[model samples]
Target: MNSTHRKALINKLGKERYRTLINNDSFPSLPNDIKEAGLLKKQSNLDQVSHTSESKSRQISPTCAEIKSQQSSHLGAVDFASASTYEMNLESEVVQADVVHEQNPNYVSGNSLTFGDISVPISSCHPYQGFTKPDLRYPQGDDQEDSNITDAQEVFEHASLDGIAAIFKGLVCGAIRTTSPLADGLKPSKASVTTVFPPWGAVDCLLSLDICEASVEPLAAALFNATVKWAEKSLHIGFAGGASLTIPNSEVTLKGVRDEAIAQVFGSEIQQAIQQSRIRIQEMEKGKLTTDCVSMIITEKGAFISLSLGLVQGLEIQKKLYT
Candidate 1:
């Protein structure tokens, strides 16, 4: 049969049945043209399937691109929201910091202002007030008034030469009486001495003494004899006199006598001068006197006393008397 005819028959019988018929030799073998037509038909079907698949892929491309664009836009919106949140948090923190700054008194935000070690705020500062001067003068208080009243009741009198001579005589007798028994291996002696005073007073008397025994060391004996001679000369020189009672063989030394003897001898006169000065101050304070000066000059044959009343101004009565 012709190729066109066989192809038509093969299509009608189907390929498997046709091939079975040809193999049984019940039909003629298939021609190249028919086989080629079969191959061409299969190729056309594959091409159609490939074309449909390409159409499906082309149709899905726009939807995929739309989804990707939607996703990108959603992510951008989320990022913008997060950024806005961060900005809000930062603004809130800044606001809180401002509130905290406002609460503190010492917190200064602008130009730093300082005074010494202190941080000063310009807004809260005021004009500097000058320092107040202290009240350094003496207080005329109730205690001072009471003291003045008490002093007013007492008699104020200047030191007298006669009164001082009597005091000196009593003190000398007391000293000799107390020291005589203590001066062991020594004899009580008497020496007539003259001590010229400053223009204040003058005195002449027989000075008492306790002389060392003849068994004393030669050096001590010579010193005692020399001191006795020097005492006479010193007393004659007035202001330069160093007259003191000597009690040998006693525990007390000549150095102690030089340091304390003048003060001990004139202690009473010093106390009297101090009392008189206080009375004078009391009088001045009560407006009973015109002058605030108090001058006390106590003098004896062997000692001199001069007291300064300058320290009494501030109500401090200090002992500035020197012998």
Candidate 2:
């Protein structure tokens, strides 16, 4: 504690160390060996931390790859399921269409079955063939005549009028014979009358008389004129009343006849009724009536009259009976 001993310690230690030692501070200057050892320990800890971080990052890379692979597999499964469902739906639709087509043969492709009015396909209708009455003799004459009569009877039994024109012709003939005066007066001359079938499919009745004073030609001619007048008065009341009597109802009745004929030909399996009415109203308005021709030929023979009638009126009423 002498001044000399204190001055000697201060000189050995240095002024800053002396001040720290005097203050009794905890932090003191370390030796070089101890400081170097502490620095080495800190550097070793830093290296270990860096190596652990790299190892964790390496482990996380594999886990991320596995997660991405699972996500891609899930997406592929979903896409396959969607495609299968779409294909199943498409197949179901095709099967339904095939079933519908098999159920209805009349349902033509690209055409739907409609209950409303539709156009009639005239081309599809049967072609017209005129009526032909069998030639038969009541009493058997020779063997040949008997054979001929048998053949005629067979033909008559099998004959069928399958066309609109033939049906209309038969209607007119039946109506005139049943209701007109022409039938009564012309019965006597029926034996001598020649029936001609024109190439144009028209029926012509030709009557020729002898030039005798007692000949019934005048009465026949008078009866013929009277028959025409009767037809005009009775049938043409609401129809066209000129040489051509075209009744609007004629086509309608003919259509009904067509239905019946179709039924008979195609059987009950097919629909007998036409779904649509194909009436040509424009033809009616244009005054294009059905044609009928009557011609008189005066020659060495007494008198000749040929009558051809087409589309007679009042046939609609008769159609109801047959239908």
The TM-scores, one per candidate, come to 0.15, 0.17
Model 1 residue 60 distance off true place after TM-score fit, in angstroms: 67
lDDT by residue (1-323, candidate 2, tens digit) is: 55556445544443221022233345343344344445545655665565446435433233444444454566432222112111011111110122323222121222221111222232332111221333466865589675664464310011112222233332122211121235557522112223222222223211121122223233222323211112332322122233433332221111112233323332232211111111222333555332113233333223343333222221221232223
Regions more than 4 Å wrong, model 2: 1-190, 199-292, 310-323
In model 1, residue pairs whose N, Cα or C atoms come closer than 3 Å (at least 3 residues apart or on different chains), thus clashing, are none
Quote the lDDT for 148 in model 2: 61
Which candidate tops lDDT?
1
Question: Measured by TM-score, how close is model 2 to the native structure?
Answer: 0.17
Model 2, clash count? Answer: 0
Model 1, position 22, has a per-residue lDDT of 32
Give the CA lDDT, 0 to 100, for residue 190 in model 1.
27
Candidate achieving the largest TM-score: 2
